[model samples]
Target: MKHLTEEDLVLLYYSEPEAPAHGQLHLRDCPECRGAAESLALTLNVCSEWVVPEPDAELGRSVWAQIAPQLEVQGGSHAKRHWARHLWGRPRPWLWVAPALLALLLGTFYLGRVSKRVESPVMAGLSNAARQRILAISLADHLDRAEMLLTEISNAGDSGAADISSARYRAQDMVDEGRLMRQSLAEQGDTATLALVDEVERFLLEMANSPDNANAAEVQSIRQRIDSGSLLFKVRIIESNLRTEGQKS
Candidate 1:
């Protein structure tokens, strides 16, 4: 019969079945196999008797250092192996540092772009609203000043020509402001504002073109036009409405 192997002896020493049936029958019948198994058991027990020393913390680093060279040879690429080596021992400062700084800088740049994009719509809305408010308030103020001018013209004393240059200059200035407002309104096809501005424009142009020093006849003629058009009342109402709308906006 063939002798049992060292493996069979080890299994027999541990009482592990090497075969399901007639297991170790040869070992039981043969003195040589039996002796070999007992000898293996004795050797194993003697090895177990030697106390294993506990490893220190440095043992882990020592083991990785020992394997690092073999890993580098198998890893293939010089750059990749260099990076992997950094994972075991003290990494060169720039290895992790440069990549971390690059990531942070990229993150900040992308974040700034996102924030500006996110805020654009809101900022645009605010700017448009502010422009509208300014236009509304300006138009209201212009109307208030024009209303005063027309009132003065309508109620002027009939005494033969005083220095009417102030009123004429004021009328020319109003015309200028009114012309700009009218052009803007006309472009938008605002028929209502156009109508009021038309009435105010006629008064302003007439006053601006009339002689600097005017007679009672001219003053009366202008008053007649103001009364006929109800220009003052119309401007006052429109100005009041615009101011209220501007406030709400």
Candidate 2:
């Protein structure tokens, strides 16, 4: 009464040619394996619907090409499959892919940043003024997005769990994107700009960590923080300054 492993179920789910030969036959007759497969399928469908920031096409393709072979070269397929099935085949098999996907995303993002630094020749001819203007424009866009996140949270009056879930996801992305911008501003010795970005980042992080079904009190607390700091006003001031700087050249 051996059951199919998570790897086997995943392979069969995707109809990979190398999947275990009897995997389908076993699932047809075994309720346990079939249930596992269904859970895995549901998780996969949810993952497919995630709205992630689109990376540049060429950069994504090049990075994928360079790292794709490493995925296959890790261990002998038979040995890896055996280990995956034996030790990792307990409950919630879909959870196993979470860490792997997170690592892959982080690795890809790190490499993409490094690649831009390596390809600095693309911006080598730009004058200092031109670079400053470009930075200003980029900062402006970042502030605009951050402002929108704040507005959403402010206006989410009596929203249900679903609205909270959507806002949390968007807040998470805003927090991630703000990290790089904050670092850039700090390095440029723009303390005023850095402070505003830092403030917005903190607010975004709070929203990201809020309970999925945040209660009225929790939502109002966040709004109060926004009002107390005049955060939206400060953001608008910075956005206006950046726009003026961007228009200078």
Q: Rate the local accuracy (lDDT) of all candidates.
A: 0.64, 0.70
lDDT of 1 by residue, 14-77 (tens): 7776532343788789899888877887889998899978888699899898666535223111
lDDT tens digits by residue: candidate 2, 110-226: 565778654344345666577667667667766776676677777887553224766676677667667766665665689989988999989889988988877778878888989
Worst 10 residues of 2 by lDDT: 73-82
TM-score of 2: 0.53
What TM-score does each of the candidates earn? 0.47, 0.53
Candidate 1 Cα misplacement greater than 4 A, ranges? 1-129
- The clash count of every prediction, one per candidate, is 0, 0
The alpha-carbon RMSD values of the candidates against the true structure, listed in the order shown, are: 40.5, 16.7
| Candidate 2 local Cα displacement, residue 193, angstroms | 0.8
Off by over 4 Å in 2: 1-119, 158-162
